[model samples]
Target: MTYVSVQTQIYSPQGWDLSDIYKSFDEPKFEQDLTGLQQKVAEFQHHYRGQVSQLTPEEMARCLQQLEVLSEQYSYLDTFANLVFCANTRSSEAKQFFNDTKLALTRIYNQLLFFNLELQDLDTTQFDELQASSALQQYNHYLNRIAQFRPHRLPEEAERTRNRDMLTGRFAFVQLYSVHRGEQDYEPVATPDDKQVETPAQLEALLFHSDGDVRYEAYCSLHQEMERHNGLYGFILNAICQDHRIESQMRGYPSTFHKQLLAADVPESVFRLIMDGVSDRIDLFQRYYQLKGQAIGQKIRTCDLNTPWTADDPLLKLDYKTGVQTLLNALKPFDVFYANRASDFFSKRWVDTKVRPGKASGVFSFPTFAKHSYLSLCYTEDYHSLFTLAHQVGRGLQFSRTRDRQTYFNTQPPLLLREVASIFNKLLLFDYLLKEAADDPLRKQAVLTRMLEDQFNLLFYQSTISRLELALHERAAQGSFDHSFVNEQWLEFYRQLCGDAVEVLPEHQYDWAGMSHIFTQPFSSYQYAAASIVSLACYQQYQAVGKDFIPSYFDFLAAGSSMNPVEALRQTVGVDLEDPATVNGAFYYVEGLIDQLQAML
Candidate 1:
């Protein structure tokens, strides 16, 4: 089961082929596209810079079409640079190329700032006329979304300055944190034969080790390294919050979180409702942890949260090919087309699963509107890896559908809806695994425990982090704070969530510094909690309606940003986020799972 032994096997993990994006960074086509994008941006600015307010509906449609084309070209270059850099963050060449591309794209974005600024200048009657026109129907969603920012829009020069400043300001700090994290080598776990963990992914995998001491050491090693750089991490986080607060005030947002809500196209009340719902269910979350501790015959410590249910539990292992087949088989029974769409990621070599040095930690599906999205993973050939693959493939499928059905302007879904498909896929995979282990009590129990752990991670854990983020923002508004302040706030939130069910270790304070999302995507963790609730609700509908639910589910995925997330969920799945019962229903599903787990005990 050693990583090295697994690597030596015949079916060694595969890395994705970037040939579809570009054969190489310096390829002729890449250079041509770079130059072509610059030319197009110039032409676009020249033609439509000041004419948006005067354009007729047909002309407005034409302008948007041109902008879409420009966006596709820009995405191609930008996505390529990012994918390359993420693959090997330690590569100096990759870093330089990524920064260079960002600079070029920022300049282009600055050049085109006038388009939106001028659009915001249109009189209400003119704007209403354009929206009511048939010719501009396709861009109705895009136009409305842009209009939502009208009150917050700055002057053209100010907007351009903000765009350019981001490269050196907030964006630089984010990059620094990513590189600093990716380049670290954690101290080896002694009980685990002194194996050196080179990346965060490897250290994370160790948390699931059967040996309790090994898990604890790995956890300490991770937090200790993070604590070592707490000062830098704290500074980056503070700067990001300050920047957000300053910009929010200048834009006249009612609150710091207002801008994020507007971007998500979600109402503040909906977010608060979801957060409150999860907060009310902390007892259920803690009860599950207590049950987990009983099953494992020990008090659950923070490090042991992901540990195996028993020392002798049969660890579910699957090679990459078998894992793919398992996922495809589970998906095929749900929908042949869905299975085939996921299969394309494998058959087309669009997935990178190799665990290698310098590769980015964790898994993500990098998306591009102009091309098929690519998935990255550090697969370890375990059930966790299989589930990770399923989660990411779900993202790939959702993006695939969006790319097929929506225009570039509407391709990216809001953050709240982004995880629906992925979480649904995990739920489906969980059911399939549980069914496969029906005859073996231990195996079935293992599967059930894994699902419960995932639920808590998504629902309770993310909710806690989201609350901590809000607290950090609130504190930042009052004055500046360092890593010690962050630690105290995180510990407080952690204690509130876990209660007496699990021990909150001192090292847990440093855990906040390791969450990339807090720094990279502020105020986003609640979306995971909210999406989990929505996904569980979707799963309940699927179970009740059986195959009849497929069409609407597909429609939900394909809706993209064309519709509001709340409206889309209500229309497609009959789940209303505005209703408290929706959240209650999702937790009831969790309660059923806990009841089943209790019976097994």
Candidate 2:
């Protein structure tokens, strides 16, 4: 049987037009926003910069209010470009608008560099007086955040140069990789009936193909193709590491990864728990692999890992409209404010759900706050796709609240806090599906097993990878970027974690190639594991408290980057980051789920 490549172009359905974000780039409002933002940035510099340190409390308050307005305007315009390009990445006009807008914003931002620098220099008496003022007290979180960074504050020109260089150099490696070394030749694999499957997506589906030979052939073939680019991938990896280590030294950071954790207010022990906890639980993964092999009556191969748990015939998939409706029905537990926002998001085309050729794989929701959250993904009606939708929508809700409550400087929320909303949505969907499938023993077992497997992937498998990321940076900090030694260390880590049941394919030892984090953002992969653990604790809170939990959850969303991550979690969901129990609680929850799945089997 020939399996078609899952092109996302076929998923579009009517009533999902994205013009609600903005009619088109030609709209008069787009031009107005652009011109208005440029003026605001110029005015801010002219009015506030030289005098910000000496300003009275009232004057400082007024400046912040103006800054907030300017932030909202920029978000609205940027969101419009984001929504447009996400809808159709191939649109040259949309792409050009984004480029033009970004360059303009950068010019405007260069003028606002004095805001933080001047504030850091404020006299202690003046700063304390401002903090005591009613108008600024609400922004205490924001004030505290800036004060914390005073130690790292550099001379304005030097800091500005470093920031600009980072974007132009270290950050550009991933973009270069995407351009030069992306997917290549199709080299189709033959099936038992003598047909071919070309794309990786097509090859993926064959993991469930009835013929074992077909699954094994596609597995080896896919990895073989990826192996051809090893040298190129290693070059990219080396460049990224060298850049990070050099910057960390210049910035006076103890370690490269330490810089990332400090910026997010995360502790090293929090990461260590995830890494070590996952390593300790490899036996469970071994059991899972053994059981999977037994169920399929064949040894598990890399490609065969993704096959469906059941042998049922594939169902006819719904188009995007029907998919949105299905998602809406699943999310009915939230209040009308939440539900209506989600409804508008789908109807207004906040999500670019169709898969177009050359569009990036995987899904991401860009949350600009105040204006809109844009989701980009190659959609399908698969169960996994639904989970992806849930993830994005959850992020949208958090963004919605933050935009309403915080200013632009505080908009990002810490990455540590940001992942909670997205992961919470995944948990919500997972719980709902588990309950819905409770009646059917086999289907329940399959769905729950898959859900647990996903948890393991995020909470365990990714945690191991996160450790390798941290170790790589530490070694690099000491001036060692030995590619051979690093690869061998990675293999050792995986071998210890995976145990005897699973074989690490020889070529697959270069697993680090697939990690986009290493090339793009250093030491950021651990956030997945950190957030996964925190999300589980938050999920339990939701279960225990029900509707009463909504207010606290919303408060968490609204906190943005204003508070340290540990303080934010404690304030929002009552999870104490320093306590080993919080991390251990996450593993215990997954272990319970695994035990439940095993009982069903």
Instruction: Return the top candidate by TM-score.
Output: 1
Worst 10 residues of 2 by lDDT: 1-10
Best model number under lDDT: 1
Query: What's the CA error at residue 340 for candidate 2, in Å?
Result: 3.6
Error of 2 at 507 (Å): 3.7
Q: What's model 1's overall lDDT?
A: 0.86
How far is each candidate from the true structure, as Cα RMSD in Å?
Answer: 3.9, 5.5
> What lDDT score is found at residue 235 in candidate 1?
89
lDDT per residue as tens, model 1, 194-249: 55665666677778889888888889999989899988899889998888888888
C-alpha positional error of residue 223 in candidate 2 after TM-score superposition, expressed in Å: 3.8
lDDT tens digits, residue span 1-601, model 2: 2312211222353223545456778888878878878887987888886888777777787888788788777767766665665444455786577657666665666677789888888877777788888878657777876776776677788777765675467655665564333335446899766877765545544655656678777776666665666667767777788787787677777777877777767778877776776676667777777777777676665555556555662321345655666566556674545656676566566676654444544566777555667776655546656666777888887888887887776777766677788888778777766677778777677667667766767766677777787777777666656557557777887777667656676756666665666676666667777888889998888889898987888899888876778888898878887787888888788778777876776
Where does model 2 exceed 4 Å of error? 1-32, 76-101, 123-128, 180-225, 313-322, 334-337, 480-489
- Backbone clashes, candidate 1: 0
Kindly report which residue pairs in candidate 2 clash with one another. 8-355, 413-560, 413-561
TM-score of each: 0.96, 0.87
